[model samples]
Target: MKIAILVEGATERAFKKKLCEFLQSHLGQKMPRLHFITQDGPIPKERKLKKLVETLLDNNGYHAVIALTDVYTGKPDFKDANDAKEKMRIWVDNNPNFYPHTASHDFEAWLLPYWTTIQKLAKHNLSAPSGSGSPETVNHQKPPSYWIKEIFRTGKRGKDYNKVIDGMAILKNNDLMIAINACPELKAFVYRIISLCEEDKIIS
Candidate 1:
């Protein structure tokens, strides 16, 4: 299926890659045109992720547009982000084609607790050492490993905890996981294509 994804910044590169890998593993056949629309709007992040998805989409060509991004909490504890998300919701609702699907970490913290636990590394005496890791590592370096260890100690994945973050949390918590999962434009297109395909199957 051909799909377009718009994300806020490129922090979720690993997550995106995992998603594509999941899609490939599940579909068996290659996916068509997975477009990642970002700020540069030309290249979709440096990693081979762009080329891999592009080639896959070119061959199979499913139609869908997905957007992904965090809650964009602009201020301490993401207060401004909350307001910004509201504005974005209004825009999405008013838009002609794009549909907004989202998730909030606060509620979905159970979904991806890594965000919070990672931040606690400093408190656990696992602070980053000076000039050891790569520059990018330094830039995005999270708290020490102890934090993650602690969180994982509780459980792995939201499923184990009887929680489901599946983009529904966005409706109330202003999350963006849903938008990221299904590109609004691309989703509409995919739904249409699937419908048509089903119709053809029935007639044929």
Candidate 2:
């Protein structure tokens, strides 16, 4: 099946390379046949993304189109995220067969498959010593525990209230994933997407 992939921002082409690697190794496909569309930056205020997707759907010989947008949970980025989701919903309403997925945060598509693992790795990063004086080392950790607790807000049932739980579930269901600024551990996310596609015969 022909699939169309689109991203909201410009990222190092490494992501596409990784995606291609995934397809070749697992799906027996090449990059030339992949339909890729990328925006220069965050989506526009007027939501031009709708037109872009519509054009791709109208012209491309794709069997399915996956729209991927990064999460902007705050201020301007938040607005962009909400707008993008709304546009996709509208598009889906108009075209029932099209599939669109949005990530709760940037790089979530990459981080999702190994949710439990990523959570542990993030915790380890948080536990590491800050000033080891290694130029190659940069801190990459989840927000403080207090912050997580606050977001989840322990009610009758422990921290299971984490809002991110829903976001992760959404990622797990996607047939295709597009991640921007994904760290190394995120390869599992791509693998998971590939695995699901193969299982459901979405890719041959």
Candidate 3:
């Protein structure tokens, strides 16, 4: 049950250790090898994406290829999560083995679930975003990454959010299920992986 996840860049790749830890607890021996491939940017556009998926399936030994992109990428490639996924599905032409997932605004949206941990790691006491503290609601305008980066910047540490490092720190030892419950996109991502691995759906 090997799977490949195509993402934007190194920030998501930093998820490797924590993500695996979470998967192992639930899937146990059924946990699959998840390969995360980066685009050095957002998942390739349209035909290029189709081409990449085809290559992974036909040339590489992967069983399935999943693409996760941020709806709030610097450019307005996608309006929102649904729009982003819909576009990818259309672009991929609904290939059965190809799955498209998104972080509502960006990768940092996923990190928002661990605010307490973030404050601890960052040595900051910034409050969570006002609206419901729901990660997904952190909009594209301000975006979760901006809030996180701001917190790190103004905090006692006086540093910026290093997407590559801080993201993994926030996720470490935290329960993935918490974020899954908070973010629908994350739930969908986990659902696809769990379903492919043939495990009982603990997420529901």
RMSD of each: 14.0, 12.8, 1.4
* Candidates arranged by lDDT, highest first: 3, 2, 1
| Candidate maximizing lDDT | 3
What TM-score quantifies how close candidate 3 is to the native fold? 0.94
Error of 1 at 30 (Å): 6.0
Off by over 4 Å in 1: 40-63, 75-89, 92-97, 106-204
For this target, which candidate reaches the highest TM-score against the unseen true structure? 3
Q: Summarize candidate 3's per-residue lDDT along 1-204 as a digit string, tens digits.
A: 889999999889888777888778778889999998988987898999999998999899899999999888899798788898889888978999999999888888888888899888778898988752678888877988888888898888877889888887888788888888898888888888888897565644
- Clashing residue pairs in candidate 2 are none
Which residue ranges in model 3 land beyond 4 Å of their true spot? none
Tens-place lDDT per residue, model 1, 145-189, is 222344434443323221222222212232333432323322332
The lowest-lDDT stretch of 10 consecutive residues in candidate 1 is 132-141
| lDDT for position 39 in model 1 | 43
Query: What is the lDDT, from 0 to 100, of the residue 61 in candidate 2?
Result: 65
Please provide TM-scores, in order, for all candidate models, with all chains considered together.
Answer: 0.37, 0.47, 0.94
- The CA-based lDDT of model 3 is what? 0.86
